[model samples]
Target: MKELKSEVSGFVVSLEAKAGDEIAAGQVVLLVESMKMEVPVEAQMAGTLEEILVGEGDSVAEGDVVAHVREA
Candidate 1:
């Protein structure tokens, strides 16, 4: 499994990927509200989403593991 981490400190605004979902490389997995803007968090590689570590409205810092993806 590979960890998908937050790149900025912010509130989780939305999640576009879910557990068991097949994701493509560069697909937007989640959105973070930071600095009054929405920042999209993308998958680094194509894989199956295994878990989501945070919910909408949850706060996260840079490098915080947000989800896990298993090799497809």
Candidate 2:
């Protein structure tokens, strides 16, 4: 399993993938709003998105694990 981490401190603007969804490496799992900009949080490797640790509107810091992905 791999952890998808946020790149910046921000609120979760949206989720692009749900649990159990197949995700590609570099695929945007969610968007984070920081300084009025939307930053995509991407999966580091292709895998099944197993869990989303944060929801829309949830605040997250840099490097926070936003989700978990199991290698396919």
Candidate 3:
């Protein structure tokens, strides 16, 4: 399993991947709004999305685990 963490402190603006979705390494899984900018959060490795730990509009800090992925 792999963990996807937030790179910035912000509000979750969108979710581009969901649980059970197959994702490739470096694929954008979500966007975070911080400092009035939208920051993309991407998958670190190819895998199946196992869980989404945060939802749209939720606030998250840097290094927070936002999703989990099972190795493909």
Candidate 4:
């Protein structure tokens, strides 16, 4: 499984996938809000969505694993 990480340090805005969702290479998996801006967290590769490590309303740092993708 490949990790899907947050690029910015911020609060989670939304999560679009649950465990076992089929995901594409560039799909938007989650959204984060930082500095009054919304940032998208996209998948690194095509796969089935695995665990969502963080819940909405949680704070995260850069390089933090937000979710996982089991490679297709």
Q: Where does the lowest 10-residue lDDT sum fall in candidate 4?
A: 12-21
lDDT of candidate 3? 0.95
What lDDT would each prediction earn against the true structure? 0.93, 0.95, 0.95, 0.91
Root-mean-square deviation of each candidate, in angstroms?
A: 0.6, 0.6, 0.6, 0.7
Tens digits of per-residue lDDT, candidate 1, 1-72, equal: 999998999999999988899999999999999999999989899999999999999999988999999877
- Between candidates 2 and 4, the one scoring higher on TM-score is 2
Candidate 1 segments whose C-alpha is farther than 4 A from its true place? none
lDDT of 4 by residue, 1-72 (tens): 898889999999898888899999889899999999989899989999988999899999998999989999
lDDT of 4: 0.91
Clashes of each: 0, 0, 0, 0
- Rank by lDDT, highest first: 3, 2, 1, 4
- Which window of ten consecutive residues has the lowest lDDT sum in model 2? 1-10
Once fitted onto the true fold, the runs of candidate 3 whose alpha carbons sit more than 4 angstroms away are: none
Scanning candidate 1 in windows of ten residues, the lowest lDDT window is 63-72
- Misplaced by over 4 Å in model 4 are none
lDDT of 2 by residue, 3-38 (tens): 889989999999999999998988999999999999
